[model samples]
Every structure is written in structure tokens, then in C-alpha cells.
Target: MSQEEKKSRNGGRREAEPERREKKPSRRRRRAGISGVLLYVLFIIGVSAFLAGVGWVAANDVLALNKPEHTAIITIADGEKFGNVIDDLKENGIIEHKSFFWIFSVMTKSKDKIAAGTYELNTDMDYRAIITNLGSHSASRQEVTVTITEGMTVAQIFQLLEKSGVSTVEKLNDTAANHDYKFSFLENIPLGKATRLEGYLFPDTYKFYMGQDPLYVINKMLVTFDAKLTEEMRQQILDSDRTIAEIVTVASLIEKETDGTDQGKIASVIYNRLDHPNAETAGFLNIDATIYYVTGKTVTQADYQGVESPYNTYLYKGLPPGPIANPGMVAIRAAMNPDSTGYYYYAMNSKTGLHEYSKTYAEHQQKLASFGD
Candidate 1:
């Protein structure tokens, strides 16, 4: 009886142990599934929050919202890279995020359209408006209008242009000396010094952007010179056995020497001396203005022979290498058409406030000596 009871009890205990192990595993599986579902929900919520935060920051920067009032002058220099411009905007507090703005610029194609110049920008400007404000014709860009008068020297004109903030003197000189301007008048003119385009930069009023390109500034003046010299004027200059350069050089001398009324007579006197090279003047124009052009000061008695520049008419027989100053159309016309006269010498009469012409050096000296009385 004891052996039968022990075997039944052991078999029932083993079956019960298997059922308990299966039930325990089911309960543990339910609990683990619930924990995994909860973690998945939490991860989704965290990701959504992070994306929303990033979107909010990007929107604020694009729309320029919640930014302090800040005004700054952003200068995009000539040949300045767009990356450097973005860095400047970031440094000036005009933009908060450089990478976002750069991406936005690429998307909108604003990087290629933005012009190089000084522009007034503020923090209130959105990314789009900032890009627009820095454009070529934007009103935010500063401009200055300058009027160059007649007879102004190249150096003086460059200085005036620099003072007006149109461009720096160094940039102007470099461009004038090196930039190959496309114009018929500037064709034979070599590129080495700023004075190469001296007489061709016609004087006129011009409106230029602050920090504008030096080539553009110089081209504007050359275009004016081309337009001012009509076809008729050019043909007349070419008809004579002289280059346009020589005519301009003679015109410059006439502009500086004449008292505004005697340009034709002065022109005649100049041609008479040049035509008779072996006369008493001995092929020397002996003009005092040319000496002044060399010395940049009033010519004294010693300067007539002291100065050795090619521009010195006392030293050089023919025309100077180039123009001494920019001449007006009136003086240019006078150079083209000289009055018929045999006068070989002329002197400015201090008493009459006009030039007194003489056919001989003796008469010229007599008139000069009488001016002192």
C-alpha cells in the first residue's frame, strides 16, 4: 500500500511543477511586452519634441522674429566670397545662424545675386530682405554723386573720387593702370600708369556706389569721353596729320595757357612755333605751362632750363608724351582749328588781362618788358 501512494504523489508533483513553470513564463512575458510598448511610446515623443524645437529655431531666424533692434553697415568687398559675407552677417548680429542662412541662400539662389557694396542692414530684416537689401539696385546701398570739372588732372580726379567714397585711391590707380578698358580711344593707350587714360576720362557728374568697383568707376568716365567726342570731331582730328593723342595734348596746353577768350590765337601761336622748327625758338615751343606741368608749380626763370622732363616744352621740341590735363570741348575745338596768323610768340599782358601776340621774339620781349611798367 505505501509504494503505490509514493509513486502517484511523485508523478502528480512533476506534472504540477511543469504547469507552474508555464504559467510563470506567461505572466513575465505580459509584463515585459508592456514595458517595451511604454519605452517605444516615450522614444517617439522625444523625437517629435526635438524636431519641433529645431523647426521653431529655424523659423525664427528665417522670419527674423524675436530679434533685438540692431543696425549695421555690411560691406561686401569686390570679389568677396559668399561664405565670408555670411560670417560678416553673423558677426554683426544681423543673423543668428550661419549654416541655416547659407542653406536658405542656396535654396533661394540669393548667393549668386547678391552684389558687392556697402549696405545698411538691421536685425529686423528677414533672411530674404537681407539678401534683397544687399542686391545691386537696393536702396539700402549708399551712393555719392560727384561732379568732375573740366581741366582736372588725373591725379586730382582720382583724389576727388576717393574723397567721395566712390572707391579707394589705390584701387582706382591700380585699375586705371592695369584694367584693359574696351574703347576705341583707349586702344593704343598702353597700360602701365594711371595717366595713360588721362585726357580720355571726360569730366562730368557721376553717381557711384560707395566702395564701387574701380574698373566700373573708370569705365564710366571713359564712356563719357567717347560719347562727348562726336564722329565729326574725330574725323576732323584724323583728317589732319596728327593722332588723337597729339590733339588732346595740344588742347590741354591751350586750356592751361589761355585766359578763356584767346584760345584760338594761342592755338595759332602754338602751331606757328611748331611749324617753323628752325625759327628763332629753334623748334622749342618754350611754353611756360609745360614747365609748370612738369614741376607742378609756377615756373620760375631757372625752371625753363632746370626741368628735364619730356613734358617741358623748353626741352622737348614736339608734343609731350601725353596730355597734361583734361581739356573741355571748347579747348579741343580750338586745338583742331587754329586761327590763321603768322605770330610766332605770345605773352599774357597783365595790364590788358589778355594775351599780346608778336611775330618775332624781339617784339615778344618788348611786350613782356612793357608789362612790368
Candidate 2:
């Protein structure tokens, strides 16, 4: 009786264990499948929402108003209508949709608050650029450059300054003639002759913003020149037994007469000419710079025949009224201490940047003739 009862109970327990394990596995599989289906539905809904937004933005500009870039600083000029302003932004590629910008403008209630003036507008402008630029000013600053060569005349310098947004050279020319510069060299200038400070203004590159004052340019150049021409240099000029004007005058002539190496010696010859009356005929500076000064043009055969100013050494004697052009440091140093040389006649070959120096006129002429090859 006990064996039979034990066998029946064991069989029932075995069947129940198998059924419980199987049911547990089936429940787990069903739960996982339901979770997977829910996740796929959510993914499809997210994709559809994204595509709908893209289409809406493409069709209507109003959605563009909500874009973050709309608040950027985009300036709109005065008296322009909202539509025209929007069109300008669109043309500049700042706004992708016109309707978006209008909606933004209306939502922000800035339609009438917009001011007129120069503006800075860029591509990322969404609603920010429209409203930000609508406020006055935000214009991009422009780049400016000014250049003056080493030997430009005051007139030339003035023209350059004006062109670079400095005051016009004509105004400065008038001021110079009226003794407004007030420098001693300028003070004694004859009524009809040009004004002072022709050579005193140093030449170099300069930069300034648009609408720079004419006086600012003049002061900057003069300050630079004075600073470069230290007290020690001025004393050296006085020691040479020449006034500042005479030193610069001779230096200018030496600059134009000889080619490269002979500048110092050529300067010495000019000093010698001043010392010895016959040196004019012997070494005879016969300088072309004097002609350039008088005629305000380089030498040509016809100018010699035309009426001449006192600056012309061919027709007149001594240095001209002022320096013909701004002289570099080389010419200034040459005038201070000229080279020791007996050679007097000097000529530069037109084709080459070379010079021929001769002790006698015949030798100089021979060198000039030989220069043809």
C-alpha cells in the first residue's frame, strides 16, 4: 500500500515541474516581443515628425522666425519697408524663408520698432539677424591703407593723403601758402612760390581709417621726420658750414646727379663748387634736379627753351627755393660728410643703374660715349 502511494505522488510532481518551467519561458518571450513592437512604433513616429517639420519649413517662412540665428545683428537702413528689408536679407542669403522672418517680426512686435541705418547682416541671421540688424549701426568697419614713396613732392604727398581719406592736398597747399605751417623755412617763402615743409615731411607707408583729418597726416609725418633727424644730426649739418636748406639742397642735387656708388663724392663736388667759383665750369654740378625743380617736370630738350624759374641752375645760380623731393637718409648723410675724391664729372647710363665718374670733361664724355654699348 505505501509503495503505490509513493509512486503516484512522484509522478504527479515530475509532470508539474515540466509544465511550470515551460509556462515561464512562454511568458518571458511574449513580454519581450511586446516591448520590441512598442520601440519600433516610437521610432517610426519620431522619423515622421522630423520629416513633417522639414516640409513645413520649406513651404512657409513663418517657421524660420523661430530659428536661433534670427536674433543676430542685421542692420536695416532707414525708411525701408519690412517686406523690402526681408527681401534684402533673403537676397543676401541671410534668411532661407521670407514667411518665417515675417512671422518672427510680427511675433516679436518689432515691426515698427525697427530703426534705419547701416547694418551688419550675415547668413546665419534667422530672426536674430532681422531684429538685431534692424537696430541702427552694426556696419562692418572697412580696411584703409595709405602709401607715400621716398621722394614724393609735398603736392604728391597731399594728393596721396587725400586719396587715402585724409584731407585734400589742395587745402594743405593753400594753408602752406598762407603761412599756416609757421615753420621758419616756411615763414620766408616768397608770396608766389610754394609753401614750406616740402622736404621736411618724411615718406613711408601709413594706415588710417576713412575720413582721417589732413592735419593728422601732416603732423604724423613731421613728427616722424623730426624724430629721425635727431639733435646730433642737426649739429652735424651746422658743423659743415651750411644751413639746413643748403645741406638738403645739395643732397637733393647729389641724389639726382650720380648713380649708386658716387653719391657721397658727388655731394663733395657740390660743396667744392660752392667753395671754388671755377668748379662750376670744372666739375660743374650741371645738375638736372635743378631743372626738375624749376619746371616741375623732368628734363626734356623743349623745357630748356621754355621759360625757366629761379630753381634752374642752368639759367640761374645757387640752390633752389626748397627741396625738390623728400630725400632719404643716404642723401642726408652724404651732405653731412661727402666722400674725398678728385673726380668731378659724373653721368649715369640710362639703360643701366650704373655711373661713370671722370676727373675731366673729355673723360666723362668718353665714358658717356662708351656707355652706348
Per-residue CA lDDT of candidate 1, range 9-35, in tens?
Answer: 788453344444434567888999999
Residue-by-residue lDDT tens digits, candidate 2, 46-130: 9999999877875444334444432122335557788988887777556787776787778888788677644444344446545
lDDT of 1 at 8: 93
Whole-model alpha-carbon lDDT for candidate 2: 0.65
Q: TM per model? A: 0.63, 0.56
Q: After superposition, how far is residue 89 of candidate 2 from its true place, in Å?
A: 48
Candidate 1's C-alpha runs over 4 A off are: 1-135
The candidate scoring highest on TM-score is 1
Worst 10 residues of 1 by lDDT: 14-23
lDDT of 1 at 294: 71
* Candidate number achieving the greatest lDDT relative to the actual structure: 1
